[model samples]
Target: MSERPVSTTDLDSYIADLRQLQARRRPAEIPDHVVYPAGEITIPAHVSHWAAQRPATTALTFEGTAFTYPELDDLHRRLAGWMADQGISRGDRVAVYLGNSPEFVIAFLAILRLGAVHVPVNPMFAPAELTHELRDAEPGLVLTNRALASTVEEVQPRLDSPVPVLIVEDGWADAIAHEPFTGDDGDLDALAALNYTGGTTGLPKGCQHTQRHMLYTAASATTATQLSAEPGFTSLCYLPIFWIAGEDLGILLPFVLGGTSVLMARWDAATTLDAIEAFGVSVMTGTVENYLELMARPDIGERDLSSLVDPQAVSFVRKMTPQVRADWAAAAPSSGTLRESSYGMTETHTIDCVPYGFAADDEDLLAEPVFCGLPVPGTDIAVVEFGTQTPLPLGEVGEIIVRSPSVTDGYWRNPEATADQLVDGWIHTGDNGRIDEQGLLHYLGRRKEMIKVKGMSVFPAEIEVLLAQHPLVESVAVVPTDDPDSGQRPVAFVLPAEGATVTAEELVSWSRENMATYKVPLVKVIGALPMTATGKVRKHELAEDAAALNR
Candidate 1:
């Protein structure tokens, strides 16, 4: 790709051409109405609408317990009112620290209903990691289950102020007795949630999204993927609800379409298969790792998965091979030959490109590097030069930038970051990719040094800092190496302290104890790390070396 900056007129023309291509690929009519004419459509609005329209409809099912639309609405309303009684008002941030349970969904909707911002803390985060978010967000209250209340309490004293902690089980009775929230609709521009993403700076940054952004995400995803919200429309929720994609598919899409959502606390291949068969789940989305686990199950062949419709997978870590696709098709004969695939990030609330009615035999399209399909309706994407914002020509690798109604406003309380990333209404997604002649986007790799294990973003700087703390290690640099099943795994190059000795296995074991499973790096002992003349570690060189060593 040319480094020379393209003229503004030329760049605009290129963007226009890309949009035209996207228009050509768009469906004639999106199956559902994504855009709402109402001034400010919020999550609470969706819940209330569904509650009145389909009171008896099953809205959520979790571990043998089912909650109907009206029941869920009542719970959320009462919870919102209870939150108000606790002095939690609109614009205040409320952190939700819990696993994927009915309580997680209830708390999330309750926060939105109260017009408060929801801050989802990764349940896998260690106390220190959790503390960082608490200090940064300084939320008014943290809602957690009894199992995780200790973690929240541990981080409470570390915050700038003494924030209240609401244990879900203890609060449930009070919330049920509390009056339902009868507040007016929230302004579309009001902040809805603060999604924290790993930063290269070794800290987490919160992405501020508005009510309008949330609604648009749900609408665009539904329309682009042709997802149905009919009575039988059901989705498997195995992915973490803390993540953006998970929130989109698991909560927003189902609630908006008035479909049933089967909730799982975590990914378990066997349980997921059983749920799919039992509930007749028609929609599911997960990383390639998820599918591989299902395929590895001996009982997979016997399980009936015909209810699955257009199951999608993010093929970043491991490309879905022809054989795997064939096996999946055979296993779930009702879901045609091809399982859908797409590309997205947390910054953009939902996916950018969807297969938009792709057929199974379209191998030419699927062969592309995790072939990201065309842009969804009301979203525009461009491939621009890495450093400069100049648009690149088609078929050339460059930075991928996006402009969409659902794209986040900016990072919370981080104006410098906001200015650096959100430029001229376009989020400069530090992701590297190219647009083919057919208008499909192909993900080459990330321009940033972030490591993707499975579909989770793991920052190397965070891991390096932790590893460097070990007495056995003097220096360390983390790099990502391609993994057939995980998309990419982190490999750490460590130089032992002078006259000290440490084994790779020892460090790997230590990592498993100290960090989240996905963030743990595969240890590779090296005498010295490859570095440039300025003494900065050349991560690219180390990545190449790690790749070779892995092979």
Candidate 2:
């Protein structure tokens, strides 16, 4: 199987056909000036513009502490100045290893202001996981809080060279007292951030994004999600700031629109509800797990959630059902409707499809199990024959490919992987889907061996490699099993070493100790593994077996 050669004429026709589909499904016109030209403006420039125009407007609210636009801009500028004093310069990587706090936002802006690339590290990462990213990114400085300082220290020795660690709590107070940064704005094409995403074959790879990419994502997300562009437009942000979605909504969107974001250090149903009620949050985003947890809150019905307008969610953890949507609408009448569904990846910086403004009872949306709405403006999507890149006709299921200004430049330090994923300006998304006649994307499933647990990508190969290290394990096959609350959970079919005894509990426990919580699989011991004629484990059969176990 290989990609078929597509002629110039055929390609042009295919693109025109895609545009027609988009026109059919296009939502209302985006408000004027809501979406800025891509590659023309940087995020720091947005901040500066908003600060100059709406200096007194509240820009962020975290745990009762608020920062106005001017104050927030000044803090980031001062932090950028402090970072420069520490020898950081253009193109240097600076890792932000903090959770969803005000410090994370400050650090993010500071890095971008100084023309340095931001490296967002998951605060939940264990030492081994953190070490991999540090070694790969080789950041000049790591910014973390006191709580997670030990995690950074533990991984410091593993790096090829010693990197400086700046504790957020200890450094912020003094940094804010220094003179603000008066440096030149970073070039639009210069690298802005290195977002790490899990690979199908190995450890996570960093997606290299530039200022243009980030600005484009923020603009498209703002317009596509239908966020209010007015000042005082409040949003609840409990999502991790380290992730692309979190960065877009919690930091970029609010700044771009001169709005206020109420941040939570971590998600707790009670706390989230309280913040929503107290701040009159108008917009928010979350995964299925977060929504489920909020719905499960006993006092959910009594809360005043009338402030919510356009809440968005991804259904990777579980399919969004009519009942769930109804329940959500009932809980927040002002929300006017259930959360709009969208599709994106780290490679795209967050958003690709925007379903906002689509009727809740649209027949096409109801019929398609994975109906992610039309591509946002300045973005194009197509379904092509796998391997060959030949354009498939409308309604034909094939590999979903994307061409957008927001797509990552490529993977950092992995030219081979970059070549495989990015080709001729189109990102070869491993996802399989078809563009229906109505212009909506109907997701089939992944074309690769990957599992999404609680909206986080988990690869079987990564887990298999870790479990193989167990002394009593001889062979292992990891497959995704259906999960109601989480989209899918990993299940391990294990073959114990000859004459060795290992209980499922023991292996599960070992996995908990060695891997991230989301990567640990439900272990099932098997006497022998199903194999193909070529001597490879039959993962499809294992997936079926795992599904059967659920029944």
Best by TM-score: 2
Q: What is residue 142's positional error in candidate 1, in angstroms?
A: 1.1
Write model 1 residue lDDT over 1-551, tens digit each, in one string: 23334466766788788777766765677532355422236777777787888888889999999999999988888888889999999899999988888988988898888789999999888766787788888899888888888877777777787889888788778876799888865556788899998767667789999878888877777777766555777888878899878888789878877888899988888898899899888788876667878878888878778888767776656666667777777665666445556677778886777765755476534556657777877788888887677888888899998889888889989888887788767788888899888777888787778877777888888888878878999999988898875778889999999989999999988887657788888888889887899999988778777897667
What is the C-alpha lDDT profile of model 2 across 1-551, one tens digit per residue?
11435454666688887787677667656542336632256787777777888888788888889998888888989999999999999999999998888888888888998999999999888777788899999999999989889988887788999899899778778977779889976667898899998877778899999988887777777776666566667878887889888887788777767778899887787888898888888888777667878888888888888878777666765656777787777766666466555687899987888767665575434766677777877888888888756788888999988889989889999988888888777888899999877767877888888888887779998788778879999999999998876768999999999999999999999988667798889999999999999999888888888987655
Cα lDDT computed for each candidate against the true fold: 0.80, 0.81
CA lDDT for candidate 1: 0.80
Candidate 1 C-alpha error for residue 370, in Å: 2.1
Total clashing pairs in model 1: 2
Candidate 2 runs further than 4 Å off:
1-8, 31-34, 37-39, 288-304, 468-475, 484-487, 493-507, 524-530, 544-551
TM-score of candidate 2 versus the correct structure, residues matched by position: 0.91
